[model samples]
Target: MSPKNLNVVAVAYDRLSFFEFGIAVEVFGLPRPDINPWYRFATCTAESGPVGTLAGISLQIDRGLKTLDRAGTIIIPGWRNIDERPPERLLRALRRAHDRGARVMSLCSGAFVLAAAGLLDGRAATTHWRYAERLQRDYPDTQVDPKVLYIDGGSILTAAGSAAGIDLCLHLVRRDFGAEIANQVARRLVVPPHRDGGQAQFIDRPVTKCEDTRLTSLLQWLQAHLTAEHSVESMAERTSMSSRTFARRFREQTGTTPAKWLTFER
Candidate 1:
């Protein structure tokens, strides 16, 4: 990657979502001596004075929006509120950065910020399922896909939720470096090296405790045997259920057909 492209900036704000912000820090800010060259991460805030988080913690932000001027990648963590508009200056900075070939990403509700900046216009994006409807309603020009965990729309990316942000970050690592390096970074972070961007954000239905456990076990088994060919009938047999019942249950628990889920895992 070009040295300029290694510059990563994460935006902070009042009532910041700490988990999402930390995800950016974890993925891009942490020093990675193992890798030849790594992203240079920094935080900037649109607001002056100490920014307060929802957890009551106050963060002193030294860098301002100017930091984004040279950033090659900008990460917007979950915004303070989906309804509240971000500062116009911040949005303009994002536009300028993006216009200059920088990648802009949003985690969860932060997609709203990008939407407000007109960056998501006519682009496929996603956010937390809880906020998906509002995003679609408000930004009619953007394609809001609530089912997937993230959308890597070339220069623009959006993650579904806080946890999904990690998946997207690891994906960026894979793109900037390679599978081996990204895998090594994932190992250090103790997370899965890859989760397909198209994977469902969540299961569609609630299951009984026992059923949930069984489903988890089955999914784990499926992941462990991704290379093996297995039919729905075989999977149903393993769970002692009729194929029709198993298929329905599986779909309810995974929000996808068994074949599609298996393909994603592979």
Candidate 2:
């Protein structure tokens, strides 16, 4: 990749999502002297004055939206609010960057920002499951799959939530530098090297207190015996519930079927 294509710029805004922003910094901003020609990262902002975060902290960003002009990859962390539209200038910068062949990525609610800029239209994207429906509703042109961890639409990528952002970052590393280098980065971060973008999001769901307790115990047991061959019948028996009941309860508590959960775990 050209040195210009190694330049990564993350956007900061008022009421920043620190965790999501931190994901970008952790993946790309940190120096990796061992790797030749690693990414060059910087932070930029569309807003003037101090950029405050939800954690009651403020950021001092020296770079402005014009930084996007030189960015090869632009990261937009979770937006402050899904309902509020980003500044028109910021949107235009994104469009210009994309038009000039810059890769753009959004984490969690930041998908709203990309959508607002018309980058997600006619493309498949994802965001946090809680906001998936709203995103789909608000941006009818985009295909929103709430279940996936992320969507890699070539130049435009969107990650589901905070942790999913990490997965996406690792994926970008893998894409740019191959699995070996990405794995080294993941080891430094103490995270898995890869997670399929198609994996289901662990959506939150309400479960009865009793069922929650039982499922929690069962999950622990399954973790300890990951190599064991198991079936729904066996797992249901372990939980002292009928197979049908177990399947329903498992989906209720885990947002996935027992088989899919087991596959993901392994």
Candidate 3:
């Protein structure tokens, strides 16, 4: 459905996945003046009161299930468990939203929630590769493709994993606003405007290096000068440290090799 009102409401619940939630909040929730008539983002819960994160931290959610009724776009971040079913009322609300022509989306394991709701039956969908088989098995009618970063089935969308959620959200931006506006959002977020949905789920993700003050300072500089050539030796020299030590510390701090980090930074 083409909605002139870009009101996006994300569902938040107990054991809320922080990163996936952040993706929605960052993309839709943030104000983007560059794109006039920006999205109106809010959060809703199945029940009221504070919701806890998977790590047991408390999160205060904004509205209740009724809010889904008003949302032009409804996003389910990451479902906490594939083994357990989402609340029946939540499923009903989703179904109601979809029936009324609201766009519905999921991130990571949140696809399982849609599957449980029977929204994904006979539809192309995806999720974090680790849970792909289970999602397919649980909902035999849905076509689950594990390799892609996300899937766009018009009204229903699903993203593969944490970072992939960003891609999915941007895709929504492109669809709703336009390519130029979406690219502007990507530039502000410091991410690519698009990563094809078929991109591999897992790549060589390097271990994060310790984010000491030195590395923090260095990263800020790297972001400002992505075109500048960088190497272990060059970085080490700049930091006034030996190359070997610099390499080790870099991995510990950034969680990836210097080469990989520089490539992404650029």
Candidate 4:
């Protein structure tokens, strides 16, 4: 029930991205004597010793899978490959952690590992947008939400992209401790205290009129009048084009449907 009582372990592996793993270490692994008196950190690996990173760097992980037993919270930073199958032992370990009430999290491509373990089946989860389609194609039973930054399913959690991991981790801190303690952690980490994942990852800037004055003007006008109810027929009238023609042109210029784009801008 207390923040200091948490024992956190970050699962690492060979040929992993140091940055993704760093997020766990930065949030839970590192010593924070100022925040709590009982927070502990450890790195768990399938194999002991140094592991290779994407950038030819190596990280030292002295503890093996045995480290998992002591962890109240277990984080899977990432897996090496999605296509390759995860080891049964690792999957069993994760399932046991879940069964024992240990909180588990997967960051970015780490969702693939959880999927392989069959823990994410029939659950709403997310991974990097680049792999969203593939994840859906591979795991039909799971509801893959490519929109939100992360999904917190009580015991299990998954993050979308790299940076989104920070959001999810901070959210966990807020949930476990409180806004004040989470804010303290955020201030120490120099990150935002809170960010609604529903917020757009990247703001869509209005297109410049120099390239296509007509379409750009139409987009600008639509954005300016988002509060006003506008339909395809209404927009077609304003653009002075047939509804079908306007829809086709909108897709060709923006690579998205008019309705979807409007919702995003709104």
Identify the candidate with maximal lDDT: 2
* Best of the two (2, 4) by lDDT: 2
Q: Write the per-residue lDDT of candidate 4 for residues 193-258, one digit (tens) a residue.
A: 998766544556544333556777888898789998888999888888999998888887887788
Better of 1 and 3 by TM-score: 1
Residue runs of model 2 more than 4 Å from their true location after superposition? 1-4, 203-226, 230-266
Per-residue CA lDDT of model 1 for 237-264, tens digit only, reads 8888899998999888777788888766
How much is the lDDT of residue 222 in candidate 3? Answer: 79
Model number with the top TM-score: 2
Model 2, span 1-266: residue lDDT tens: 32348999999999999999999999999988999889999999999999999888999998999999999999999999888999999999999999999999999999999999999999999999999999999999999999999999999999998899999999999988888999999999999889999998884433323357888898889989999999999999998999999999888878788888887777
lDDT of each: 0.90, 0.92, 0.88, 0.82
For candidate 1, the per-residue lDDT at 259 reads 89
Model 1 — TM-score against the truth? 0.80
- On the 0 to 100 scale, the lDDT of residue 95 in model 1 is 95
Give candidate 3 regions above 4 Å deviation: 203-266
Which should have the higher lDDT, number 1 or number 4? 1
Tens digits of per-residue lDDT, candidate 3, 123-198, equal 9999999999999888999999999998999999999988999999999888887788889989989999988888
In candidate 1, list every pair of residues with a backbone clash. Answer: none
Provide the RMSD of all predictions against the true structure, rounded to 1 decimal.
5.3, 4.6, 8.2, 5.1
Query: In model 1, where is the ten-residue run with the lowest total lDDT?
Result: 203-212
Off by over 4 Å in 4: 1-5, 210-266
- What's the count of clashing pairs in each model shown? 0, 0, 12, 0
Q: Which 10 consecutive residues of model 2 have the lowest summed lDDT?
A: 203-212
